[model samples]
Target: MTALTERTEVRPSSPSARSPLGFAGLIVLLVLTTLFVIGLAVSFGSVRIPVGDVWAIVVNRMLPGVFDVWWSQARESIVVGSRLPRALTAATVGAALALSGAVAQLVTRNPLADPYLLGVSSGAGFGVVIVTVLGFGAGMLGVFTVPVAAFVGAMVPLFLSLAIGGRYPQPTAIILVGVALAQVFSALITFSLLVLADERQLGSVMHWLAGGFGDARWSTMIFPVSALATVGTAMLWSARRIDVLQTGDDGAAALGMNVPRFRIVHLLGVSLLAGAAVSVAGGIGFIGLLVPHLAGYVVGIRAARLLPVAALLGAVAMVGADTAARSISSSLEVPVGVVTALVGAPLFVWMLQRRYRRAER
Candidate 1:
């Protein structure tokens, strides 16, 4: 645990480093791009709304009596009632997952690591299945049951990993423990879905496991958005610590960091973000794996520079994927997770191959 002898830091390209002004410009571009993607997502549903009208509808809703009643009630309903919440939820969940992923990779020093590398997704799925199949939390928490169950379930893996890792927890120990727990939780979810879940519950369970913002509402956005704001701010505040930790345990110790304690706190934060995202979006994958790597490529891997870009890039990717999921077929909505997996798998391979090439050089 004291030695980082096995770990190798992933260096960023020199040319990718950002000046403050250039970084600000990049942030602006990504923010605008995310907004554009959200607008597209709002416009692409069953009844297509133009982008201009989408913004207009949003403005009217926010500042009532300001704009005339030009747009139809039905159009407003579609935008406000359905797509707006869904799109915003997608963005929030994306940002949460991406930020969680960044922190996970940073703490673990594993390039391929993701938010769910700690088993949070599996735990969340198991929780959802337990509630949906067994009706365990039906009356206890009301509409809040699933999310609360999910948050609790997600904590299971964290506690287990910590217990198994003992006092001086190392990145490798956490990864191995997480993988084991993830598999166990995944198996439980499968058994529950297959044996306990009835025909009626199957559709929703499958949709949720595959991940989509189909059920997203203004009400559902509360937890994830709040978690992202809190956890994201904490991560930004600890940017210097992240930079130190990235230099490995030896370097972190020299900088007076309590490496194990720092890792533990980071894991807890990751679980919260991951749980919030999973509770709302239901096991959305690949954003965590893909976005940080993409963000690193653009911003040169400093946590300070990398985090915001990763978040915005994630939002853009998620909204774009959600839009595609909605627009793919007139008859059915595709799972946004499925879309992300389809894109993420190949892109990840390319990333791996690119890394190998760089290593060879």
Candidate 2:
């Protein structure tokens, strides 16, 4: 068979699936839900500020001297100083991860592809571990140490996969390579922490590896926000090209698109996004894997349609998970990754089963 004839096929969504009104409503609903979730997340930390007061404090801070300071200094500090940043960080990290997942799915043409699954998260964690072990505080590199390290680490697997898979590799080959690399990186992280880290450092690294937003602050938000804005926008701008690429390399080349160049740029974009999420949130899994699939159910499989919905859903899930982590234990905060894994694992299995059933039909 010719290259085009040998390509794997993907069925496009039916005309019934295209509904602009429904898409708009979904966006509006998700936006409102995101705001509500952020408010709820800010309201229910250990101190327990009211939801109404949380928004008021936010407005007061933004428009200072407008709303009277009815809330105490302590309450204001908790709302604006601590909880708000954490909540927003979760939202931003979630969106970045989801976008990365959507892009991974598109490029690999694999529903199972995700940053976490492909070892990108493990690589990022390894980078963070290296910095921590070396005692390389943010002094020299400033706030960029973790993010830079993470992006570098993330690119390793992506680059390796591209090289191993060749100019036009199969999806299964890329997935296997990613899975193997992920396992190797994860083992390295464990070995390094066990061998090099002190007691306090070990505990800290372990918590971060488990993933939570506790360490989040206004300063830490820069990497994720900027990454999401820049890379995410670029991906959306190239959505039609992504749609073309989905038809396989031969089809894309026939359309006069540069297939290899497109994949390289977008895959690097995906790495940057995943690295940003891991830099701030620390090895949170499933946001990337789960959110895109969930969004596709509502918005269909087009990149342009999937990206926005996935981002919003991811933001909601992360913020909601963080809130649950805090509320789940009065004495100790649960890791946000644990909550996502618990929810995601079951959903993933169901999705797999649903796919099988459809195939059998």
Candidate 3:
């Protein structure tokens, strides 16, 4: 049979099984759910807006003149200026984290790997601490200092990892180095908090480390979304090469793929994506590790197909988690990172159990 016929035969036949419609349907459901969650999530917090008012605010801003007759300026400012940016920031950051995780797993061939496994998050944290303690993130300089420090922190480890690894470095070795560096950075962060930071500064650092979108502003949204768009586009362009690389280096070499070049390109892409994410979001965890696995189970392991679906799922997961973080308690707003760990740890254990059972069979 021809290649076309072979391809056709390999695919499932039933519309339910074969057509991407089901996946498309899931994407649609996820999008709607994300919108609802954002609406509900915005209506929550210390000052609550009723659901109806929240919806009206969103509609008036989004649709402009269509709802101008009934629009309230105060409500519009709350939803459009405050909550909307935070919600979108949460969604975008989550998607970037998830996509980064998926790429790391594929590149390393390790199930446990996430964006933080490379020391990126810890490094960024250290950078932020340094700026904060040194008094650079104060007075007139505070606005731009944190993100600049964070970006530097993220880049250091990424470049170091690439340098230390040389050609064809083992994935396990890279992760080991990352863990060590992360520990070292964490110690520095603790030292800074103890020695230099005042109580208020320490409190601010602690809060940032915990991770939330409460500080998110329209300006904060610009960098990450721009980075995601550019880097995500690059990843999609090279999706076929990434898929080939998944079949083992030797297998990829045999297929005439330049394994090293492919690896470097993709790693750089992930570093840029992860670094940008850390610069803004302050190391929210697990969206990357959990979302990709969930997406793969739903959409199969084909990298080309998996990338976009995983991104969408990641966005859904992040938005949902952010909503839960704020609404779970009346008096306390839970950290986004903590919420993600709560959900991810249990899911990971379940996945491990399932894998072990499959192995036993």
Q: Please give the clash total of every predicted structure, in order.
A: 0, 0, 1
Each candidate structure's TM-score, on Cα atoms with residue i matched to residue i, is 0.93, 0.89, 0.88
Runs in model 1 lying further than 4 Å from the true structure: 1-6, 12-21, 139-142
Judged by whole-model lDDT over C-alpha atoms, candidate 3 comes out at: 0.74
For model 1, residues 309-337, the per-residue Cα lDDT tens digits are 88888889888888888878889989998
Pick the winner on TM-score between candidates 1 and 2.
Answer: 1
Best candidate (score: TM-score): 1
True-vs-predicted CA distance for residue 319, candidate 2, Å: 0.5
Stretches off by above 4 angstroms in model 2 are 1-9, 15-21, 116-118, 136-152, 155-180
Candidate of highest lDDT: 1
- CA shift of 237, model 2, Å: 0.8
Collision pairs in model 1? none
- Candidate 2 lands at a TM-score of 0.89
Q: What order do you get sorting by lDDT, best first?
A: 1, 2, 3
